[model samples]
Target: MQIFKKFSQLSIFYSEYVSFPYPHATTVKKAHKCTINHCLLHSHLVSSHASHKFVSSGGKPAGGEGDGAGAEMVGPQRPQFVLFGSSIVQLSYANGGWGAILSDVYARKADIVLRGYYGWNSRRAVQVLHQVFPKDAATQPSLVIVYFGGNDSMGPHSSGLGPHVPLPEYIEHMRSIAVHLQSLSDTTRVIFLSCPPVNEAKVREGVSGIFSELVRTNELCRQYSEACIELCQEVGVKVVDLWTAFQKRDDWLTACFTDGVHLSAEGSEIVVEEILKVLKGAEWEPSLHWKSMLTEFGDDSPYDLVAFDGKTTLNPSDWTFHRAIQWD
Candidate 1:
């Protein structure tokens, strides 16, 4: 039954991508360039793609026309790509864990920077944006990927977190970020990755009542992710549903997580795989063996034993567990 269900879903995904038109390669290339420009800008939120130079309206009038009326009007130019965020951008390097893998896969295919932090939240992300991207440089990125809300959902600040970042405030921040980028380049695309699920077991074992806190935190993260999607939609920004994709995989628990919070090497690979699928305009395909494995284990119960190459194995690490925290 599980095999049938898994195959059915894979069929649907394969069909969807196969039927849907692939985004133009040229367009994707252009978007990559734009993303680079935005990353270089750091925090100023200015558009690097702006072609027209703004002249001072206070200058003396030419002929009988007023100074403003005689001002030259510059036409729009081709769109560009931009990058934005926090330490995640830096994390794209080899030392940056999962981000490095993503960087290598997407390298040249798109211009992306991992502007994530070791421990940062939305507020901190905003601060980094302010510091890194200057007003003029902010506009070039055609595609912006946001991997945030994780740290925000945890830590001391968690108590003050809310369902939404106050609609008005959220809009204002998004507007400030988007308007500048749009002004620099009219066709920038912004994508926000929803926060992944927390390891409740780790919370139960490590900190008292923290597991419950994580549940509440995950819920809030979901809300924020939804809010971000809606906000992007309102302003014509593209959004990628990373949380849902991660949730669908069976290995997240065993292969990816190291301590129920951070991703292990294998776990990061799963994330990169999904990102690649999206960038390539592909869909998720659950392996037949993976589905069968899930059926054997059942939901909410850990796999006590694993089988490999015609032999039973006691070590869970031998198998590739999808979308769950690793025990070791």
Candidate 2:
């Protein structure tokens, strides 16, 4: 499902040298790209015998037959949860990051897709909102976790070399991000993480040797966090106020961050907890919590378990336990 939306975006992304049409077809169009569009119900996929070289539209062969054995197109397999945000999210997979934790917790239940971009603020996120979460996705994600504001809250650099977006624009960008995700599908839930606090004593400016001032502070984070929560409340979207949450910890300043800006293992744990709190409390029809989602193939095959008697030898049929819960 996620791959379905990456078509044009990836094409544009690799437009420099590589180009292709069908995601499954053994075809290509370089300097170039595309000639086949497939639907899910089709019996066979696209291929090209004449122009496997990718000179023309080597669409699906007639009567479900292609030059070679038809490649099976990837079908919908599991629910997807996307983490979309700035640097915090980009680094969420390293050093016991929250995203990595979520992946571990949700194993076999769903796919947690990371769409983080470092050094990005609300303004940068707004520009790629459509590309990341296109309105025309064949299947929208079951959930999207959004975090953008910390960078935007940075004090405007004297030479305008920082990622400081005005307060008003930040609000609007966040609002748009939420609205777009909501519009993806009625069940496509969004959880926005507000700006987290920074250790004033440890944070510094002149990042990338580009700026020459103190451009980040807890005070600014507070304002952005407040605005984020207010906007979420107004639009009925779920929000995690990281600014207040971070400060609640007694050792937040020293224990929670690697450099007073990024989160450490302990801090990332808080994010995981807060997110679980929302997921557990929300009234989404099929819950996304690990416990709520049944395991994929149920328990081990009956053969793998201790058999006290001949009746316990169910073997392959015992795997049916996983089918107890249905997506609908």
Candidate 3:
């Protein structure tokens, strides 16, 4: 009952923020709006521990239906999938951005478990995975989605340029992940999303010398995508080329991203739609119940909360506090 009350409060808070306009038109202003939205969403889920219930309740709500049913449902329940990677997945909570969209679209189709960290590199990600998901002989996921490598390529390398790890080394790190996931379960499908492109102009203008480094990083992303495809084929892992999808659709750039680095709510939706396409093509059965939940709860996506007011001054106080717990 407390959880339900908390959930109701969450719904109310999200509704308020979703309806509020950004106080300003600058990137920081928009980010502040998104940050408030995210904090509220995450507070609801994490504070009330609803996500844990969702994970451990055997595909049933805590006190929902099926209590009096004599016979178990005949059809298969929702499939459980895990998402592991970087800021993209982490950013989903604020606006249900891409992850929320994917969850809504695929909810009754698949139960997605998201494990993402902001500013995490492949090396750190690998460590996090081990800590979070100590592979068990019996408990393995049906699908694993990995979206990383952007930070690794843009780092504080001694040269202050190029990939933190060379292309070959990056490929090996990815390979290790794939192999480990496979070892967990024969049926576990792994889908690795390619990192999207950075805006050259934004980079050059925003951070001096970072633009050239980002260009090189984007190039590596291209190369890495190609290599990942080959590596997956060789090792029998599924791959989703988000970079190519972004390239084909200009709207992915114009609609989704606030800056070259991060995706707006609209942009995240595009990414989710593209990912759904891949899942459907693979004939994966997503969870309809979860999809319904998303549709019901995520109808007011961040895109709908766009600010049109012409305020120019960006105010930091409007956003929720963000202390980067870890970096690099």
Candidate 4:
């Protein structure tokens, strides 16, 4: 059985650079440089090598192929969750990004693969699908979340534009992505996230540079987001309709987005909530509690016991249990 944590859209709010063809030293170094927190980069590094038998949940190479390995029985293959799309996906690992929050919550249970490229649209995403996700079973992810349309939905007239993908082409690209993912593994799932609604007032008033002119309007975003929902429905894929969900709340402009386009902390929280709902629908069981791992507990219980080294014994009673759950 695999444990998968919900992927957060918040990781896309900030900008970061990741080199092509993973497991490269230079890629990790550049990631560390762009990230606000080094810990996030470290977490990513650990996730990258998660497929190996020796890699531990902590991201370090532990155990070996030879003697005295009895105590080090291989752990269940950890689930991998991939984030694919534009800068929003890249920035999702930022301090307040959704990807960072997801990494914290799903820490030991799963690995969050960051494949977001800044300024990329559905067209560009299609070109790198094989590189990001291979046909190999070991590299297959439990869930692949595609977050696009922000750039694709940009008004055709916007000046100094980004790689604008037309709506019909965008829909086909999304469908193609789903088809390709299905080809990879039958068990793996795909979730399509609708483009977020942009606040034209905020962009015009506060946002600077090419982004100010290039950002799409709320109306245009709605069109694209609606199309995403339809495509997902037609293709039998799950969808997180952020465009509709965000506007349902009053003053969502200030509540959800940092600028007119990016997400604020509160906005990221909303995205997580929506994603969790989709996970629940897919019947993802929540993680076990600390108290359930106590020595006094019975083996008949459904929950997993606290994992520890065979060389060291842990007293569950010694641990402090808290009900408060916080994600930042």
Deviation in Å, model 4, residue 305 alpha carbon: 14
Could you give candidate 1's per-residue lDDT for residues 221-243 as a string of tens digits?
A: 56656766677678765556656
The TM-score leader among the candidates is 2
Candidate 3 vs. true structure, TM-score: 0.59
Please identify which of the two predictions, 1 or 3, would achieve the higher TM-score against the true structure. 3
lDDT of 2 by residue, 1-328 (tens): 0012112212121122221211233322222223223421111122422122111233433334443224232236678899999999999999989998887776666789999999899999989999999999888899999999989998997787778999999999998988889999888989999999988776763243654775788889999999999999999999897887888899899888888899898899888888888888888878876567644443322223223222221112112112211111
How do all the candidates rank in terms of TM-score, highest first? 2, 4, 3, 1
Q: What is candidate 2's TM-score against the reference?
A: 0.69
lDDT of 3 by residue, 248-320 (tens): 7665546556666677776665576666656556744432222222221221111122122221112222222
Off by over 4 Å in 1: 1-98, 106-112, 128-130, 155-175, 204-216, 282-328
Model 4 poorest ten-residue lDDT run:
315-324
Q: TM-score of every model?
A: 0.48, 0.69, 0.59, 0.65
List, residue by residue over 1-328, the lDDT tens digit for candidate 4.
Answer: 1111233222312224443222211232223232333223222222322233322233322353342233322145566788888887888887478887776555545677898898788988888888777887575777888898898888664564567788999999999899998788766788889988878888777746644445568888889999999999999888999988888899897887777788887787778778767875664333122221122221111122222221211112221111113321
Scored by lDDT, the top model is 2
In model 2, what lDDT does residue 23 have? 29
